[model samples]
Target: MGMLGNTFDIEQIEVHKGPQSSVFGSNAIAGLISLRSKPITDNFQSGFSISLGDDSHKAVKGFQNIKISNFLKVRYIIDYNYRDGFRNNILNGMIDSNRKKELFSRLKVEFHPIDQVRILGTYINANLDNRYDVWSPDNNEQFETYTDSLGEDSQKTQGFSLRSKMKINEDFNLLFISTRSNTQLVHAYDGDWANDSYWLDEHQFDPDSTGYNYSFYEKNKRSRHNDSQELRLSFKNLVTGFYFNNLSEKDDAIGYLFGGLGDQADGRYDFKAYAGYFQIHHNVAKKLKVMFNYRLEKNMYKYVGNTYDNYYGDDLPLVNYESENTMMGYKGSLLYALSDNSNSYFSYAKGFKAGGVNQEPNLNEFERIFDPEFLTNIEIGIKTIMNNFGYVINAFFGNRNNQQVTISKQRNVGDPNSFYFYTANSTSGYIRGLEMDLNYILGSNFTFQSTFGILDTYVENFEYELIENVKTRAGDRETAMAPKYTASFGLKFEKMDYYFLTSASYKSKYYYSDSHNKRSSAYTLTNITIGKKIKDFNLNFWVRNIFDVKYTIRGFYFGLIPEEDYPNQLFESYGNPRHFGITLDYGL
Candidate 1:
């Protein structure tokens, strides 16, 4: 969730969803995260590691590196981690434990000041603190299994970077990059049933005199600053080639807002953003490729305090808004090679997402304005590698426009004692997907890998008359953490010094509201690892989730009925249960 500085270190991570906004952008849509690290040869290395797990997890890591002769180099890394929370409240007996601490450090400097210059510098810092529990009630006896907690009340980040490369002969080349980043976050939560009715009728009384009281609060504070710059130019020979990429991004955000119910009363908001981009790529023969891109964005907003005319009886407390967005795109790809190993490709792309400012002070200022959401993607792919089997297949089609949903409505007008939710930019969608990956190398020891994915998402042309009597349909699916079959598999083994590993993951069945009504089921997880190497010291053992799957990953709902009268009461975000870990490594 945080990766700043070094603009792109992501080397290889293939998740599959297509068109990747011309080299990663548009939040990546939901896939594509490739990071690469570890370079600098002429070696002089160091390492240290320690880990212990199970409910009280702990970790420590270290690294120091050098390579100062061939070009220039330096590296340093330090890590520390701790974990405790596993949920347990039982009406304030505490122990929802939930604790997290993270500190990441990186310093890299490289210089090749002579033959065809090159330089790089990067620095990063990250901090995170978390607290848990947000829902519980699969029937904890009329709901009082204790609640109140939801994370990220604190988070911090800092980053800086510089990159340069140049080679002016032979074919020509130049590249430059600059970056700066800062971020802070506080997203609060506590929704103890907002307004309960003993979970509706879980046997009417006693044992605590029925349960469910009320409490829901919100406070979101965000401070972000970003500055980015990029430039690229390239030219090659042999037939022809050309490339140019330019990008500039600037963003500044400040926000503070609060929600009520209980202590009753607090509100404020602010937001801002600016963006820009440009791209070009060309190659007309050998497999062909062409690309073009454009982007411009702006947003500004401000709102202040109280407007409880009984939730909007007077409706006047939001009066500053501005938005501008422009996007243009073109893409082309064609790759063919049926002779050596195998290859095939096809693609199309277009994308945009911008439009904001809506904190719900009490609405009606046009629901605080919302628009801008567009997507167009088409893809086809095939790849094959012989000598030990390897495969990849992909398919995708998507179309979306003006869709920005998130409505939990139920204010009954500023404080029916309070329970509010708002978000708008309704309906226009279509999505289709399929992806597959497999690998096998059965001889050198044993190896196997697999991945599969499928998706069909919908909702189109919904005229939004406050949901148009609801049921804004078209195959309704795109929620429940957006799932429609996802899978992962892995196995590896090696002899000599001993090594073994296993992995599995899968997800299917979704619908967590958005009119599809609550539904979540389908889970599978497994992980195991074993390692041994006695010489320089290395030993490991691990087990994670291995069959203890309770499953829930995430869920939300505290008030506002609808979607089939709400109250399906299901809470069990348990996925990490059977965890046994041990690791040790030392080298110098």
Candidate 2:
């Protein structure tokens, strides 16, 4: 709720089922996030907003725009926000406050050099600064004493993109898109080791006493850069149809050392990928339509780095390695209209997520190479509209092969001073699911919508020697944070003067890690908003997480720690608690 920003509104969206990978990429494996933006026209527009909320969080945001003519336009947005965290540093006896600040801007221009040709260009930039702490400790226990030295971390990201389109003729067209992104993170932690106190006392702390000894202090910094480009050409008619698309991407990263009185450790990694595909759609009869698509992709990786002295000494030379992967797939779909407002369709598709280099080489000199995982999906669905009511139902079954899994192990090579991290693909798995949605309007002022999805995921095989014992017990349900069921509902009331909205989301229980031993409970969250418009001004109040549920969203595993010694450091990514805020906005 709250202001939700221009990209976070849920009520203004409608859910749809289709093979989204064709357009949005592989991350849409579960589903797609559809966002609606304000319409663009040759007009002047501007708006501003301010809010105050729980945890001492305050926010101010505003945007201004202009139409320099029929061919040029510009828009700018700025937001200043601050918040105090809910967790307390037990050691330091102070609130673990989290803070964020962001600024974003966009510019667009259109040019028509000829009667039949046009060119459009756009530019956007955004910067984000986030600071937070890792609340939970190595043992599944919470720290009552929080320390400023124990909880400090920050992350930053910036990105930009450009796209262009050309009309070759009435039946053919061409398009090109390019994008670049950069991200960086720095983190440090120091605290008392309740469980690892004995090991720290002898190795990390003074051997004299256990009372108030500085236990662990270390820092990690990482930087990533990504660049991508794509081009597409299409031609369609009653007969002889053609479509082709191609894409290429490059990514690189560097890791830096931060603390621990230890020598800095560093690593570099890079990957490149190329893919191309062609598809055709045709109507063979008045009642039937058929489509076919085929695609192929190749990926390569390079890595270099030295393990930390605590894990591996400087005597060991940094390793250099390379890997390559390739995949080919095809898909087909059929559609038939039963009536003017009703239609049914069935589709079959296959795809793969490319494998990459494992730069964290800790102990063993062996290189890790994970094979590409493949997915085959079969789905049938129907969509119908009757009067003011509409409904969509879909059922899908997917099978995945040779799934990649990461496992952590400890290794102390020649030097007694350092430690190294080595990775390998250790497991295989499969996933299948169903999804449905409905919408209805009860007269002119009220509307309702609902959506539901279910996934059944499981492990198929475990073949690694290091984790054989743990893998045997890992069942089909222990795979990652994927929930078995997810659902949401929304209600909206709108009129000439005022508007009201309410919605709720639910996710089924699932584990945070591959071990399948640590599980997170199921939870439901609700939100509400009310707003009024007067003249050219608008005001609204919103409440989120109405029930104040305490739940974890994610967890991190420290491979250095022995499993028999303690649980994987169960650092909980806590869900946001109950919060309320009000916003005032003016349009010009």
Candidate 3:
């Protein structure tokens, strides 16, 4: 789903790092982010919030809980947000090219048949109509685009989940959960960043040139459905569960390729998985403890694709592929207590991910499929609390085999406009990192927190075919999005119904793409919030990126225009500029 209800509805958030697949299934090789919403309460409560900011930013959210009876309760939440784009389009005189509009609603029902049993059902719907014309040919300009066509990205999603918990007896507990979700998404964009006149003037009607009056427009419709169920039983330091999941997705796209040629493509994918897992904790010594977890999963996947060229009236061959695999993951940890408030732990985990077919029709059979990836992580950490201070430090190393990597390349040599992307398996890779967190509380009114981390990642013995038959060895290189170092510090003070918070974060330069050596410069951001409470109302003011730093979030290296001899150059999408906002909340 595109949106996860409203942030105000969330009660808790948990962050787990390094190889969580043993508990969360696949795609958790690095970590997992878990969010839990507040439960329905018997007490009647209602609240609303309004926010306003620069760039025409506006948001409103409200929630209410109603106690219908002694045994049942209902809660509903709704949120609406709209913001004008920060970027301007000089070609069309449009300032809302990257606008954002969103609507979200959630309904939850709770049933308490008895003291030992509780059931909860929740339904959520989200609508997003956002613009995506953020790309530009000139990075020197400030938040401006020259494209003639404005892009669009929109989604409509609906989801429902049911969960029940029962205490069968003093020694056993049962829990069941089921969820269903579906999303309809439409995305369209102008692939070429330049205007028609610019391209025409560059190529001078040269049919042999790929950029000759180049016009590229692409639109895709995606529909996805997912269903999952899980049953769990817990008994004194031991937990076991069985899970089943199914997912189906369909994508239909139309592309206005070079010279306005029409290309149509359709693809469908299905995935199903079943798994059983168990976790156990035991005390091995007076001051030591041990924990173990295991999971076995079987998964199946299928892909079908068809392509056609409408302008040329040519149909491509159909593609149908199916695959199945069985995988196992496990985690083990040992904990030792040094004092009543201090503890140390060591952990090891194995994570697994399944591979599937590629939807692209332009690749050969060998390039259309990739192998699964595996990660084994080992970590040692110490956590301690001494009076008003607490700290945690950990160091971890991970080894991955058959690592899946994606790269984009031109279909033909020197034809930069024919770019296509695909995923492939690397022989091996490794990552090592150290992280530390520290917090201090003083006088019950002032608190300070800081975190620092350093990471190093390298891929070994990996090579790819840059063109039809030209193999290019990609020597040992650092992983994309892996910064060398990161640090953050925050301070908060509260007294007399008022509070103030300030934080600063820094990150070192990092590679932006694994396929190339394009890197982004190091940057830092600062944020501050001040709030005051008056009776049942709360008012707050916040400012983010106070320095107005222009940092890159994404970048690509390719040839686009003739102004620079069509030489490979860096194109980047930047993060948001400085933003300041005010919010008011009322509760009853």
Count residue pairs with overlapping backbones in model 1.
9
TM-score of each model, in listed order = 0.29, 0.81, 0.95
Give the worst 10-residue stretch by lDDT in candidate 3. Answer: 410-419
Tell me, by TM-score, which candidate is best: 3
For 380-413, candidate 3 gives per-residue lDDT tens digits of 9999998899999999999988888877676632
lDDT of 1 by residue, 386-424 (tens): 999989888888787776666554443222223445556
Residue runs of model 1 more than 4 Å from their true location after superposition? 1-43, 53-55, 76-80, 85-88, 91-97, 101-107, 112-120, 125-129, 132-145, 154-158, 162-179, 182-186, 191-212, 219-223, 226-588
lDDT per residue (tens digit) for residues 246-296 in model 2: 322222222222212234556677777666767788997898999887766
Which of the numbered candidates is closest to the native, going by highest lDDT?
3
Clashes per candidate (backbone, < 3 Å) = 9, 19, 0
- Deviation from truth (RMSD, Å), model 2: 5.5
- Arrange candidates, best lDDT first: 3, 2, 1
Model 3 ranges with Cα > 4 A deviation: 2-6, 198-212, 257-262, 412-417, 562-565
Model 3: how far residue 441 lies from native, Å: 1.7
Worst 10 residues of 1 by lDDT: 248-257
Q: How far in Å is the alpha carbon of 543 misplaced in model 2?
A: 0.9
Q: Give the whole-model CA lDDT for all candidates, comma-separated.
A: 0.60, 0.60, 0.86
